[model samples]
Target chain A: MTRRQKRPFVVFGFETTHDALAAEAVLKAADLRVVPIPAPPVLGALCGIAMRIPPESAGRARDLLAAADLDPVTRAEIEDF
Target chain B: MTPEDLERAAGDSAVGGVSAYFDHAATSWPKPTGVVDAVVRALTVGGGSPGRAAHRLGLEASREIYAARTACAAFLGARRSKDIIFTRGCTESCNLMLKGLLRAGDRVVVSSMEHNSVARPLAVLARLGVEVVRVAAHENGTMDPASIEAALSAPTRAVVCQHVSNVTGTIQPIAEITRIAHNAGAVVLVDGAQAAGHLDVDLSQLGVDAYAVSGHKGMLGPQGIGLLYLNPELEVDGLLEGGTGGGSETVEMPSSRPDRYEPGTPNTPGILGLGAAVAFLGGEGAAQRDQEQLLTQHLHEGILDIGGYRVSGPAPGSPRGPVVSVVPDSGTPPELAAWLDREHGIACRAGLHCAPWAHETMGTRDTGTCRFGLGYGLTETHVDMLLDALRVYRS
Candidate 1:
């Protein structure tokens, strides 16, 4: 039997939505492609926003946020239902 | 409570919501009105890096930074403002003392109620051949001076203790502990994260060798700023070495009091805010402490009245700060915190509160106690709301 392929991941969680937006701005200014996405329901129902970035660039995105002193709660891949 | 009720209860007429901010022990809220103004002024009017230029702006910024150091020195009872070294916060300050002062074979004594910021760094040193001793405390989270005295050995270079337990708010007897450590030929460092703004700290009277304090928590300044006070007689190596505005002759860092410890461009804006906070505290801090004492007393009495809730600490009259911890018989601490937040819009902290050894001593390890930290802006109404919510939870 053939297995279905998984989509590439993007999206990082933050403790505060404001932090997520701030991270997005910093990452974008650093010349990285990024977008602020609403928190995914599957991860958890909590208040905060998430940042969407390319799967390959997730590590770089994390480093940029940390360098800017914005700590994200978690980073996960976006999947289509 | 409804929106209208909240607005009426707070009665600020400036901000909406019941908005009871009680987490001062973590970091203060509603910083004096001047704090925000100071921060904004620094960002707008302030220019030029401190200690770096012959220009007027640089001189002005340097003067502002020096004024902040003077304020900190006055607050902590330091003999000279030059002895106070500004850092990123208490964590960095403690790290500077530890990494800068302690050698590989030296032994250090720290209390069980220390925050991770203190414990973790010392633990790292232990792995690197430094002897780290964990001095035990009483069940109520109070550190015994005698126990600290017994822990000191010939190799012990320093004894570190928190003036107030971040977890339980039990004030340690620092004066006695410092005397004991000093008698044993060991220097003492007090982490005043919880006590600096709440209680009066006279460094000369207490006789501690060093003190690390946070600017954001008790001092009501922006984060990323802290003060470290070193005794004039004692000297520690510089943690980071870079450009000092003066003494560019040698590539090595200057061997001065503050410049010896501080290197590179400092957090000028945060330090400016800290200066304003110190001024604000000097003027209105006593009133705020009185308010916090009243609130904490009410909280302690109310928690005792609530059945099955065991409050931690010595009796009511004993020396304690504004923080109170209560362990409910039926519910976990996090559950109570969440319930208090969602049901009554009450904000509080729960869990181990970053002092695991304190909890282990108190036997509240598995289930941490719910902590109600009273601050400057809290009122009796907020205390009443918290008590009512806890009562509902107990029932």
Candidate 2:
């Protein structure tokens, strides 16, 4: 998947409300700018939250969640929504 | 409440006298203007299934709830806002804390003075083979640290203590107890239902593993809302499980801060009210507590002077909360409370106060004393009026 991907996995999906918000907080608190968008049904939940960070910051965002001992559920790569 | 907000709520909020509301321990009445407005706003403008929708309303709900979590974390001195979990009330919070931590054959230390919220849950745990060691308490409603120490002979899972007694309004030595428990390698869980808004407590400084609070009591919020602050350093399990509104890919619950503990749709209005209440209490808590302390002193002194009544908890000038429970010489507590209410428009709680073990500790096992709880809006003059009403009821 990594060999075929051309864009960074900047869009993330969350399973719950607080988790989505917590990620937003963590990213913001670390001075990372992100955007909240609708999670497409294909992401495994209806009307869920997804955030898009900078394509270059994917590695740093993962590091942040790891440092805070936090994670969001894995969902399909977002092509849209 | 701001002047404009108070004016908007005037007709309804002005209907009752703040002096006559002595049930702050049970529930704080006449919620702040901001609190009421927030509750209304959450249902109207802020209405959205938090985390369950991707629309604007859902986003708004998520923002308000996140703000509430931040406010709660700051208020309780928690490091991360996500560590604060909103529950149905303090009882539910305590249940979540207790059930999440304890298992079969684990020893739990508790005070003899515990509200039914903590006591009842521990009872159920005891039935399931959790060993409960309830230490003896002083008649004044204070726990002897030595008694707590004596009971800690066994390896303990957690020590459950109320920060303040609901019956006697006694302020316990929490830091000391936490130290003793930590030294013994047991985590501490505080039932802060009676202490949250009434006392100054820094969860970080106190170093308790967990804290449970009722939004209605001292927090100045409405009923059906509570808060729990868990130390992320401790790996505590959660009781309820369902859709957390985030991780949907797996049948197994995902591990995170609150989503691991809180499932199902939250009480949005109540959480909003709690947030507003926390904001309202921000600068005014210390001043209100000063007044509460003054009135508590008068009530304590006047009751003793009346010659037929004895007050429970710490003596005059000793550290105490704003609660006072008096055991009268001649009458049952219910009659006294009713007479004061019917004749003088005063309000007080009667009957065991749901702390049967507490009642036993204070020598009121069969009949509970009349409990008067002080809070934000009351004054010393109001307390004098209450004292006069008690005298007439006595005569």
Candidate 3:
């Protein structure tokens, strides 16, 4: 039997909500799918928000951001339980 | 006070809280009446944006902002108002200083008693080749100025220390530390989150290179306001670059001091509130400080009477501020904190208080102590309530 493939996703952390929102706008304008999510509580409960994107496009997304001279405070892989 | 009466008092109190607020180390409460009035007046009359226009409203807001800068400078003993750069809060101010000053491969010395606001950022800098050296604090949460002096090496760029330990309310010898750091060609950035409103901070005389302060805590202003004092001689970088009020025609951000540090639309309302808070403190701040010290002393003494309870930090009658950390023999810090809130209407902070190094120093890292933080608006009755609550919990 063939197994179904799992969809890959990456999470982006920001230092401020404004930065996260700015990243979201930049990603959407570049025609990439992005979703703003609440910063995970497990990440030390700091302020600000985060974003999730498809893992396959994550590298491209990061490059796009770099080209725009915007840096993500942190990036992490999202695991499904 | 009864729960109903306490709730009513909170509403009428200048801080507009609904219960006892022992979290002044986090942020102060019962702000001076002028704080509320100033915020309201700014929102009503100071309609235009500050530093953006030459109209009456703009000028009014600018005046208010300038007044706040002056008050903060004078309060900190800063010689020039231009040295003060207003930001969101202490966290932002710390980040501004850290990211602005330190490059890769630089060495920074910090105290074991620093808040995570300083610790975490420096840790990140560590990943980028910056050396973060931690100077240890005593069991009482006091850092030895001599230890800091010893930590200094030729490559040491700056030393970051807090003016007071928020967890234990132990005041650091900032004057001596500043002197040592400067002698070694290193600048000092003091985290004044706990000191600005609680004690006299004369930055000019102290001669520290930079001071990061929280407006909401001791300054009795709204949250989202902080100040960073950079000495006139220091050449620092800017963390955020965007639209400053002026110099829009230039392709690159301006290199001027305050404008270079401050970007985006300023928090004009918060600045106005900060001005009023400073003004109100100037009149009655000293008396309030004295009362808080007495209440803290009473609470500290009373806690000593309880069996199986250990008080952290310097002993009572020592030179300390209005903060106390008590560890109970029977239960965890959170348990006692919850019990106090449930049974006695006492509100206290539990856990490491964002200062793990402090807990590690005191050997209380296993279970952080229950912190009793007092501020200018607290009273003897509050102390009695806290003591009675702890006593009942002990039994």
Q: What is the DockQ of each candidate?
A: 0.01, 0.45, 0.01
* Candidate that would win on DockQ: 2
TM-score of chain B of 2: 0.95
The sequence of per-residue lDDT tens digits that candidate 1 reaches over residues B289-338 is 77778788888888888877888876776778889988888878888888
Clashing pairs in 2: A14-B246, A15-B245, A15-B246, A15-B247, A16-B244, A16-B245, A16-B246, A16-B247, B140-B313
User: What is the number of residue pairs that collide in model 2?
Assistant: 9
Q: For model 2, how does the per-residue alpha-carbon lDDT over B15-111 read when each residue is reduced to its tens digit?
A: 5532367878888866887898999999898899887776788888988999998998998899888889899999999998999899989999999
Q: TM-score, chain A, per candidate?
A: 0.77, 0.72, 0.78
Q: Point to the candidate with the largest TM-score.
A: 2
Interface RMSD (Å) of model 3? Answer: 14.9
The candidates, ranked best first by TM-score, are 2, 3, 1
Put down candidate 3 lDDT per residue, B1-395, tens digits, no spaces.
33344345544555333346677877776566688888888889786676555445655566577678878778778876778899999998898889889989899999999889899889888998899999899889889988998898556999999998888889999989988998898999989898888888888778888899999987889888999999999878888888754445455765755677787778988988998888877886667777878888888888887767888999889978778888898999999988876676566789998888888888999999898888856767677767777788888
Better lDDT candidate (1, 2)? 2
Q: What range of 10 consecutive residues in model 2 chain B has the weakest lDDT sum? A: B3-12
* Fnat, one value per model: 0.00, 0.67, 0.00
Q: All predictions: root-mean-square deviation over Cα?
A: 18.2, 4.3, 16.8
Using lDDT, rank the candidates from best to worst. Answer: 2, 3, 1
